[model samples]
Target: MKMWFLGTGAGRPNKHRNVTAIALQLPEPETGWWLFDCGEATQHQLMYVPLKLSKLEKIFITHLHGDHLYGLPGLLSSRSFDGGVTPLAVYGPIGLKAYIDTVFSLTETALDYEIVIHELEEEKQGIIYEDGRLRVEAGPLVHRVPCFGYRVEESDTTGPLLADKARALGVRSGPLFGKLKAGEAVTLEDGTVITPESVTDGVLRGRIVTVLGDTSPCEMAVLLGKNADLIVHEATFAAGLEEKAHEFGHSTTIEAARTAQLAGAKQVALTHFSGRYSNDELSQLVAEATAVFPHAIAATDLSMVKIDRVHERRAGQDEISS
Candidate 1:
């Protein structure tokens, strides 16, 4: 799993950054990308990365703010023009469906694929999506609107089959091996029934990623991001701008980092920057976050992060997750 920051600026666009947008790249089988908060000119931002608009599987909107959603109608419309045939699903707070319907209806733009809309109103927290390899959860975030933060956790329970162990245990290439790899008990041709735990490492490992939309520091946000391999939070302002962030229901750099630290996150990436900050100012903003959490970083447009492996263990526990 990997994450790419398509746009990181908050509220509006600047020469160095655009508004909120992120791309969560999952593994093959469900290899397409999931988008969060398509800011204005997001389609243009796609040009900065190796992303295909046609490959977008789902879009999650943080709020109805123009900077967060102005690119939606244009991107959805362009998807059809770019020959996207796969069905696309969009999840967001209420009024999202109405927004899309109005735009598509007024423009009379027909899509080559299906568009599924899920409008969330209540305070929801649960598994919103699961595609064998990846599982997505949604948590209510404290925002001006009924916005949400997403947690994309890779199911570490899908341990790969130990081929050498299977061979050593007298298993061969056939249905038996397939069944065993799937955590099932199988009988060999010689009438020996082997359990999945007998020949496999019996350990499952995968990555966990949490992405928070425009939100203020909240308890639910910290709980949802606990122990995440990556936590992407909106740091819309510097320390002195806390009042601005609170007024807008956004977060400051230190607050974001503190949330990551409290959540036990391995790495925290501060994004969704305010346009007022320059390159040097942004660097200082990152330093503020780093003071709270050493692993914190300020993400820029088109920045990519790959999850190699995560090792979690107590002092006396064994080394794992390689």
Candidate 2:
């Protein structure tokens, strides 16, 4: 799995950044992708991405803010022209369905594919989506509007099949061996009960990624991001501007870092910066975050991060992101 940022700036578009949008792609267990927060010009930004629209399976909206959702209609309409015919799911807060329906009704937009809307209710906290491989959990967040934070968690995979050991144990390569490899107890013809414990490796922890919407520091953010491999939070203001940040229902660089620290996150990725920060100024803001949490990183548009890979944060400047 991998994540790519389409827009990292907050509120509105600027020469430096577009807005809030991130793409999570799962290539192996069948190539598919999910989008988080389709802000203005998000579809245009996808032109630079190598993924196909048909592979886009779901879109997760954090809140109904214009900066986070304005581009959703355009992106959906353009999906038709891009030859996307598969069913797509959109998950968000209660008002999301009404907003989409209103826009489509007003524009009389024709859709070639089915759009499934999952409206998350207030105070609802549990798994929103779960297949055998992956699970998504959404919880209410503190924002001006009814916002949400999302946690994408992968299931722990089973260890490698012990084919050689099975063969050496006088077990033939067939259905019985399959059962043994599945961590099941199998009694042989001689009534020998073979346990899979010794043959398989211990369970490896599944990767967890938490993404939060615009908000002041809150317990929900820490809960959603607890012990996560990555925590993606908005840092709309610098450290000294805490008062302004809270007034706007946002977070400063220090607050974002504190959230990550409190959650025990391996890495903190700061995005959705207010337009006031220049490229150099954003680096300074990253410094403020890193001072608190050494693993803090300031993300930018089109930057890609692989979930299972180890990455180093550069000291002097941001990593090469395009």
What are the per-model C-alpha RMSD values against the true structure? 2.4, 5.8
| Model 2 spans > 4 angstroms off | 174-195, 309-322
lDDT of 1 by residue, 121-223 (tens): 6597888788777788888999888878888878654355778888888988788878987778988778898887777654556778888888999998998
Query: Model 2, poorest ten-residue lDDT window?
Result: 313-322
- TM-score, structure 2 vs. true: 0.90
Q: For each candidate, what TM-score against the reference?
A: 0.92, 0.90
Question: 52, model 1: CA deviation in Å?
Answer: 1.6
Clashes of 2: 0
For candidate 1, which ten residues in a row score worst on lDDT? 310-319
Instruction: Assess candidate 1 and give its lDDT.
Output: 0.85
C-alpha lDDT score of every prediction, in listed order: 0.85, 0.86
- Number of the top lDDT candidate: 2
